[model samples]
Target chain A: MISARRAILVSARTLQRTKPLRFADPKKIRLREPIVPTHKNFDVSPDHPLWAFFRDGNKTETVLRSKDDLSTDSRPWDMPELRLKSFDDLHRLWYLNALERNRISTEAEVAKEIYNGDVSLFTKLDDNHLMTQKRIKQTLLERQVAYERAQLSSPEEYLQLFEDKYINADESAIAEYNEKLVRLQYAIFGIEPDLSEYNLEEDINVKFVEGLSYVAKLKLGRYLASNPGALELPLNGVMEELPFLVRDPEVAVEEVRAMREEGVSRKLDNIEVFAFLRNAIEAVRSEPEELAEEEN
Target chain B: MKSTSFKCTCIISQHSPGHVLACTSCSRICSLIQFHLFQIDSHLKFPNTNEINQNLKHTIPFYLTAEQSFSWLIQSTLSKCHVTSLLLFFSKLQTSLRPISITSTMSFKTAAKRGQFDLDRYVGNLRVKTYKEFAKHSRLPTIPAPIPTLRKDERLIGEAPIVAGDLAYIVSGKHKGKISRVLLYTRDNDTVLLNEVTKNVVIPKQYWAANQTSHVLEYPVPIPRKFVRLAAKEKDEKGNVSYVVAEDLVFKEKYYDDRLKRWVPRRFVKHHENIEIPWPSPMSEPKDDQYSTLTEDVYNKTHELQTVAKSPFPKSVLNELRNPYSKFKKRELTEGQARRLNAPQMPLSVEQKIYLAKKAQTPVKKLEPLSEEAKDLIGSRMAEHLAKIKNPLLLKHLEAVSQKTTPEFQRVLNEIEGKQD
Candidate 1:
């Protein structure tokens, strides 16, 4: 047993000689995993603070490829893909992220959407990113309103209503409730929910029929039947089916007159007759007086 | 009265023709002639009187020619006229040839009395002629009145008025005594220059004449001779007051005795006493400002109060004593000492020393003894090297090398030259 113990001691000595002495305590050895040798390997360890940002293999590859392309022997600290665990190192990483985010045209808007969804996450970012996020939210809201206006048939009406309704609202309230929703839908989702998809000219024929409510269709049909001369055949009938034209008094009167000789029964509502007279008088009044005296 | 007896004696001697009876009338006439001749000689003794006498003799002989013995008189007169004219001419010539008179009223007798007889009639005639000539040619108008003489009390017109000495008073300065006689005139006739009568002296135009009632003593009083003499003697003994003279006072007697073996003067010994002198005071004595407290106390107690206990010697003696002590102390080491201290350790190691010594002793490079051709080549090459090198040391080293192996170098140089050719 003494010989066995001596043999064990000799084996332990050989092991100590064979292996490198662990000068660093186990708790102090923070970076236990060795870095991968591949140029594309930009993976942050799970224990690292920046792991969540570059977790995806594709994202890691992209960041590593960019880092490799920008690598230099003199400036290891400047490498944006390098993930360090310290707060100061993380702060540098966030700064680099902010710098890259600003370089992208759409990053501001994307960052705003991210911030609005998770404000605590945005606040965790450096101050520069927080400021950029606010600026981006403002820009996105403006762009969303512009896009919404672009989709509108009558942007003036919507703009007037929007100004009247939201101008009086608190800035935070408008941004949080009204502008946020609109901006999300328009800018982020690229969707205009309030606008119709129908083309004015081509969809005129089916606008009254297709996707119409039963009550609406019945009302429209009965009105058309009683006032048969209100619509001309073929093209006129398509025109009469237009959503805006059907409600227009001058168009109904003209359609009635054009259809009268075709033996179509039609009776004009008193409101329609009054509208027709008012339109005729407005037309006479709106005409240029002697061609506006030639504006010389 | 005895002439008759003499005549009888003369008759007895008549036979000799010199004894004719002498008549009284003849005696009387002869005597009268002798008397007249003596009177004329006496009168001629006066200057210019001899000329007059000679003229009278000539005229008397001419006047006697009209008497009974006229022929005899004529002969005598003619003979005397020659002598008379000769004498009168000499006298007139002498008078005319005189030197100019210095002043009027100088008489010929006075000139004779002065032993100026040669100039006697000359001077007299000159004075008379000058006075006559001056009187005739003078611009001053003559008056019938006699010439007036200036008296002591007389004053000239327009002359400055002189007050009586007793009437004037002294105005300023001591001895401003009353003005007396006018002393000397400095300005024109109008101003009196100095008044001797006023012992203090008044310059006439510069100082106003003093009134009688004016104070006589306004000047500074004269200082006594004793005070001045004492001050001068003191100044001479001490020299002009100076710090060096004052510093010599301490141990002056001892220094004098040591240097000259004699006692110095008390003034020389006490010269420094007057300088910052501490006078013995009944009250508290003032402290000396020159020296530090220790020095002052030592100096005062030692030199000033010899009776006090613990008396120190003078500074000079103290310095003399301290000098030998300082000399006995160890001499200071100079900067070279530090360098020498480090010199032994300068060589890096034994190996370095052996290497350095061997390197120093070894010949750096060697060359085979050259043939004449090789020497000539090297000589030309060295000349070229020397010509190219402007450094004096390099040139000197090359020259030395050339001197060391001249024959081989010459052979090498010749070879070089042959190759070049």
Candidate 2:
């Protein structure tokens, strides 16, 4: 009456007579729970063939490592923070991210090979890392859109991206453009004169940090606010203290410009703010030629 | 007469006997041999035309006068051995053209680097850029990006072929006639990665390079889609899998589910129309172990669909939701704050509104007229335009018609039609 599948299954085992259950029942412990076998622990040493898979950032840690061990200092950058970061920083981050991704994937692949359907932690780790990768791109994309807008609003920034078109522009039109430019400068950067003429003591050596749009300058200001370390310079006070809302940016922009125009540039006693500002300005203004230098 | 023979380091174009242009981007950095055009009046040669006389020499510094693009022929001879020469024929792009007096402007070459000028630098630059891009692309991580097999390639998922998991037979290359799984498809290159036909590549260990450096990483090399064929994996009653050549498999755009919420691209055999070839699904979907996020919540579907599409752009995209782990980020807003700021309302307060309404009720009725001198100038320009009407009948009609417009409108007309090209 048995099916062929059952017959085949039965044929593989040795025939036996019915015996009394010594351990009460086969799988059941009537009165007490059964003892569980202890799991042996092992580490993937640097000597292992697939050790590269275990890398997190600087150190090679196992994917099974507890979440608490993850670097607390480092964080996935927000769009605003990313705006303040340099292209080189982003590019390097992207490259670093690819390595991180590869490491995670390699670990997942190896783990799957050893025990499939149990590398859920690696997958979770990957999901966590995936956001950071996406954020990098989001930051870049925001910059690209801003760059395009900046290109349209002002022909001055990366229109040197290809070739300089405004060099031979009509004198009268340029005069008119500069008049318009000064008004926009007042609105956006809070500089009274054109950014080129705004007599900040420090040389704005990199391309055009003074002319960064409201978004860029605001992030720089926010970055200064979230003081990793304070500013290097002796500031009059923090010129960018008030929190600027991205939705209504004009209010904050006007306030900064208004304060400066009234001869009251807020002084700040912060460390790396100016230093970070200088570095950020340099990063934002990086050209392809400058990128070549940065990559080296 | 030119005293010096400018035996340049650059290789002149074979098609056109002109200066060998440097890779315009790297030209500044790379210390290549130079050719000063003004230093030695290099004879501009076209493909078939003979060397021209003095008039053509005068035309050397010629400005492109017409609005239409004139193709400037230059040849890009790279230093690479056995490399086919890229003939650079760049049409004057409108974006590059500076709007100014042609007479007043200097020759474009004079303004550029003292090195050789090539208007066609853009064309050659693209190929070089593609090469550089490929170089970066080749150095990707050891692990392949997890692309779902039968999943329709959306903007979020990126571009993927309909027959993603099906067996692909190589039609060309060293792995010709070899059957392999179509591991990946890149829309940018229109190439497909074959799982079996792999190549050993050394991925750098860091951002500089990373992965399997000890034992060079084995990457599934992607070939152009043209050299691959979809061979559907079919099994007989015995359950032995055999790949059947599916040359006439037609891709049909159809709804995957009864709800019609999702559209999956599917293929069916042309010969046996009923035999639908479903793309082989990946072993498991890369889902989070945590909460399940609906597609509507994940994506901003408002752009693609006309309907509200389930509350487009979730709070995360709007910068109102903060990352759980981030302590440095200060982007999130409270529920009330988000609602208040995002609301569509006028900026003016009640006091300002009342003041504005009061001002509107009692408007300044006084109006000023243009001074006599200003009136004369405006009238004169309008008359001058009126004089240009050659036909006596039309001139009379225009003169009478001009009286209908204000002096400001006449000034605007003069401004529009006044500029001489």
Candidate 3:
């Protein structure tokens, strides 16, 4: 019913346009099921346009295969398996199932007339076939819901919401991050940086992350998100899916942007260096301890 | 995508407090559910849980990039993207010219992935659920737990000390130093069901069958963490592998496992040279006997793996959903990351060819009717860009962009003019 409505809606709109359907009705009317294959309801002609559908490659002996045999021939993709499939995969599978269903039902009717017996075996295969369609649709619905819930206009827009390397931050933010990172590396190695020029992309982004284990990269991304004025990707939206970047409760952006405007950027002439800031935080952290000791 | 179909009466200041978002639910459902195979509970827009925090707002405003800023041409998120709408719906807010409490949590600064909180309550809920399942599945002559629940202080936090498939050494009791596979673990009570450790249960008369003699059956017994220590295979300095008591098997502080993209509690074994033993990736269970799926294929995660489709859903969708997030929810085959994780095959089959033919024959889906908010956004954005152009003819496009320019456009224009002055 859903497919029919969607087809008709598309067909109605297509009628307005100049291009006609390639193999459908002359007026491009898409029938939900194949009507051209059937003959006055009961008998189907051998050479009908959709003859390939009614007969399963024109096989006859296998039509009466036992209930057990029929059940094994076709089965629905369950939730777990269906969930693994991509949208396009399911879209293809839906068509396959629809085509197979049409064939099986036609065969089932033919088998009843020829053998003068029940052809419920086709129904078994059809049931499983229908189940797969049901699950496929269910899976697609879930994806649509998830996409809507994420509130993404496009996937590109969502990349900004995460702190992924894919998200392109301004050169200023990256360069600023690079300076701090270079300082940290130098601090760790007990060496002094040139203090003048450093290319951010080369100074330890792609190469450094590529060398470090993935765990190290995550920790680094965490560090980037935690530090202010470092790498400011718009940390907006529901990050329920990608829990990679650890977010701070608040960011001191107004101050940082104000500083950026004041020309205290990458070179860090007036800004507090990593070591100095660490010392300041430590000093602030110890003040409460000292006061508590005094009270005691 | 057309954002909203019809002009909501809210445009007329219909609601109280002068600020209410139009029923985005109606518009969203219309587009989201493309199939009518199952009935969608329109009310079930957001998955509400008592422990889960719905408030995803940040404390500070953050600016999105110019490319990302172009999204208001279509849509914004709900609870998840609740904070994301700062820019997307800013035009709408300007038109309404109202301060909404719902948007108050729009703190864009912290991308707080703080998904679930109130851990204690959350844990309690999980335990209660597990207990119910255990009770339901328990058969006749069920063994009663000697100790029921642990005190809040005693209860283990983070990941349980023992999990299924872990080889645990019985430190004390009748089975002292006996190594066994831990089949199950109850976190609230430091109890583990060891495959080797079992208690003989006397068959009750109610459980006995006709002409059955009274006898005992052994069931895997739950051992306290105090009685069990994790055992691991360790190579001596001589380079021969042998089992040893995994010394100092303490959970290292929670770190995000980048491969898994979750804060997994990793256990460090001191005896094994402090090598981290990540939680064993749960083996994928074979599909039900009735599913007609190959047992090996299910175990190998090869079911329908070849039916690879270039996802219409974004790459970020894969990143977010993590290659079908539902599959990973059970941690099934985390180690299969390198096992053809990215399926490369999409040979257009006959069915697919037909699908494409039908798809082409079908008319393009109608664009959603642009909401008043969308017009406001495009107008405001265009105004900002057009303000720099001193051409008189091109300036008319700005006026024609929106029927009524949003207040934000006015502010942007004022800022531009002020800068010029």
The TM-scores that each candidate's chain B achieves against the reference are 0.14, 0.33, 0.31
CAPRI-style docking class of model 1 based on DockQ: incorrect
lDDT of 2 by residue, B222-333 (tens): 6777788777777899999977765566657765543322356667777877777776765334443332334443342212211111222233433433345565554787
lDDT of 3 at B227: 82
DockQ sort, best first? 3, 2, 1
Chain A TM-score for candidate 3 is 0.35
User: Which prediction has the highest TM-score against the true structure?
Assistant: 3
Q: How would you encode candidate 1's per-residue C-alpha lDDT over B216-309 as one tens digit per residue?
A: 3232222211111101012346586422212222322222333322333323324435432111111222343321124332233211211111
Q: Rank the candidates by lDDT, best first.
A: 3, 2, 1
TM-score of chain A of each: 0.19, 0.32, 0.35
Tens-place lDDT digits, model 3, residues A36-116: 211112232344344344334323323233344444444467787778766666667788788777656534433544444
Residue A116 of model 2: what lDDT?
32
Q: Judging by lDDT against the true structure, name the best candidate.
A: 3
Where's the lowest-lDDT run of ten residues in candidate 1 chain B?
B29-38
TM-score of chain A of 2: 0.32
- DockQ of all models, two decimals each: 0.00, 0.01, 0.01
lDDT of all predictions = 0.33, 0.44, 0.47
TM-score for each predicted model, relative to the true structure: 0.12, 0.24, 0.25
